[model samples]
Target: MFQRPGKNEYLESQERYVSLVPAEGDLLTILKEQTAEMHSLLGGLTEEQGNYRYAPEKWSIKGVIGHLTDNDRIMSYRMLCFARGEQAPLPGYDENDYAAAGEFDRFTLKEMVEHYGIVRQSTLALMASFKEDAWTGRENSMTRK
Candidate 1:
């Protein structure tokens, strides 16, 4: 099992997120559990509810899922590169821009939820393939300008 990341592993701004998980928690199990929880929660929403944005500028349910899916894909790709010892810098992304361009509003809520589940599974599979060293031996290779 991988040890929880040190404070230096991630940015200071991300401490809140990192702290939410217990140091002893099993990362793979937690991720698997969350996938089922999110699928059930999001899959049960009605079409109208999925399209309802609370504010003029906020993302709707589908948009949020799309953003999450995109985020997972990017994160997993970075993990893949780093685990393999890549040295290139990774690029930053704008979530709002990605959400807007995704046009998730066009797909049914169920589709978006399913897609999210698939992406989550892909991430899990990639992580599972890594040996313990891949999780702890590599210095963080990800960087943004």
Candidate 2:
């Protein structure tokens, strides 16, 4: 009744997410709720907290937030491609490199979070535009291993 991805819809490694997923709601609804919760969490955070990192090599809070937004955009792009039945193999990204390149330390927590919310809204619009078959569509993730 909902748009839960079916068996083999994603890679075997992603089974944990599928397993943990509750059957109580739809995908878009869950996405909306999660995004709103994340947005609220970020909105109240201080700039000092954003500058801290658990370790010298680890990402700061701002970098972490940037990474989350980047990942969401990447995932949404793949979802859009798959929903449209794109047959080309998609390229993978090096997330650590992406995090390093983002230079999120220069930006405020609010800015990174706002970007996430914007991307999420765009993702919601994209999902809303999908046809029924798109919701149930299957595609081979190039990074599956």
Candidate 3:
């Protein structure tokens, strides 16, 4: 028989696996800085370099960036649902499916990076406008155990 996770196990799992909830005042700033850093790192790559995968089955650099953008969108939506006090539990997503569907390998690195920046900006704006209570409010995440 399978045993339920104990309190300690549950807490540890959360710390090890769950995404950190940002404090409202710092959320936008943090996201902006992170987005800038990501762009800077990826900005100089050539198309061939961006499309090169580490292994045959691995994702290319562009694919990884695309995946990040997809996750950002999904998380932002989940945050909106939580802030709005939606009662239903949000659904999980398969990153592989999303990344495959995104066709990142076909995109130029610059384009993928710009797309990520745009999504990050939109997420920052959404977080900036959230009410004070919404910042502190808790909601069950489908991606979290």
Best by TM-score: 1
Please write out the lDDT profile of model 2 over residues 1-145, one tens digit for every residue. Answer: 1745566567677788778776657778888889989877878889898889999999999998889889888988987777766777778898899998999999887788888889889888888888877665444343333
The predicted structure with the larger TM-score, 1 or 2, is 1
Steric clashes per prediction: 0, 0, 0
* Local accuracy by lDDT, each model: 0.85, 0.79, 0.75
TM-score for each prediction?
Answer: 0.92, 0.87, 0.80
Give the candidate order by descending lDDT.
1, 2, 3
Tell how far residue 144 is off in model 1, in angstroms. Answer: 8.5
Score residue 103 of candidate 2 by CA lDDT. Answer: 93
Residue-wise lDDT of candidate 3 within 35-133, one digit each (tens)?
A: 888888898889999999989999999999999999999989987886787787668788999998999988788899889989998888888778876
- TM-score-superior candidate, 2 or 3: 2
Question: What's the candidate order when arranged by decreasing TM-score?
Answer: 1, 2, 3
Off by over 4 Å in 2: 1-3, 139-145
